[model samples]
Target chain A: MKAIILFGHGARDARWREPFDRLAQLWQEQHPSTPVQLAFLELMQPSLEEAVTTLAAKGATDLTIVPVFFGQGGHLRNDFPVLLEECRGKFPNMTLSATPAVGEDLAVLQAIVDFGARAL
Target chain B: MKAIILFGHGARDARWREPFDRLAQLWQEQHPSTPVQLAFLELMQPSLEEAVTTLAAKGATDLTIVPVFFGQGGHLRNDFPVLLEECRGKFPNMTLSATPAVGEDLAVLQAIVDFGARAL
Candidate 1:
């Protein structure tokens, strides 16, 4: 089975994870066959490794990790690769891959623009 | 005149602001009459106050600030209100209002879900 992980930069505030939770819920609702998990970089539960383990247990063979961030800063550019490599090394049997930050997607940006336009 | 400000949490990496720049460009292209400016909370140029000042100089009497963030953490719930108040205090004549974080928008969240679905 294939799985997806929506990775985010966690924050000190517990409420910070609300959107991530919502994202996971949205994914699960729409893509029932492809199991989805929410993972945080720091200051939150289910780090990337933990999420991978959970998915691996669920018989997920190919996993795609999507960084749920607005910028490809040091976290995505520097830290994320290391974490991903570690996950790959630990789970040698599973095929793990990642996409660029969601912010890089034109559609996502257009959605934000539309939101702004509506608010104005 | 009315204008908009796309506010975000800045990052140390200069390249992190690419999407923000693109957002401003898109806004300008699509809505040329309603000017748009980009602002950062920290570690980037054009703080909220600066953006407000720029719009004020452009003859904008009513301005809307859209928080381009995925979560309403301390940055949005706590830090942002203080910053907005300071800007309001300085630009007393200008009518300024802010919408909830873009992440709070259902359309934006749906767009992200669709992006993940497309990637899978």
Candidate 2:
């Protein structure tokens, strides 16, 4: 089975994770067949390694992580890969991969533009 | 005239502003009448004050700022309001308002979900 992890740069304020939680809920509601998990880079619970381990235990052999960040900065380019590699090493049986930051996607950018337009 | 600012949490890596740049470009192309500017909270050029000044000089009396961040963290909740108020003080003639982070929009979140599904 395949699973997806929506990874975010966690924040100190507990309310910061509200959108990430909503995203996960939306994914589960839309794609009930695919198990989804929320993971954080820092200042949050369920680190990437833990999320992967949970999914692996749930029979997820092919896993994909989507970085729900606006930019591919040091966190995504530097810190995220190291964490992913560690998870891969720990979960040797499961295949792990990741996508570029969601901001890199044209559709996501368009959606943001639309949001800004509507507000104006 | 009315204008918009795409405000983002800047990073040390210059490339981190690519998506913000694209968002501004898209806004300009789609809404030629409404001017748009890109601003960064830190580690980048054209701070919110600079962006507001530029738009105000361009005859834009009303402005809207859209935080291009995925979450409403301390940066947005705490730092951003101060910056916006400072800009408003500096450009008292211009009306400045801000929308919630782009991630707060359902369409933006749905677009991210679609991106992840396509990648999977």
lDDT of 1 by residue, B3-114 (tens): 9999999999998999999889999999999999999999999999999999999999999999999999999999999999999999899999999999998888998898
Best by TM-score: 1
Task: Identify the leading candidate in terms of DockQ.
Answer: 1
For candidate 2, give the docking quality class from DockQ. high
Candidate 1 TM-score versus the reference: 0.99
In candidate 2, which residue pairs clash? none
Interface DockQ of candidate 1: 0.86
Interface DockQ of candidate 2: 0.84
Off by over 4 Å in 1: none
Q: Which lDDT value does model 2 have at A103? A: 91
Candidate 1, residue B53: Cα displacement in angstroms equals 0.7
Model 2 agreement with the true structure over A1-120: per-residue lDDT tens digits: 989999998999988999999999999999999999999999999999989988988899999999998888889999999999999889888899999999999999999889988999
The Cα RMSD across the true interface for model 2 is: 0.8
Error of 2 at A25 (Å): 0.2
For each candidate, what is the lDDT?
0.94, 0.92
- Candidate 2: misplaced stretches above 4 Å? none
In Å, residue B92's CA in model 1 sits off its true spot by 0.9
What would the per-residue lDDT of candidate 1 be over residues A19-60, giving only the tens digit for each residue? 888999989988999999999999998999999999999999
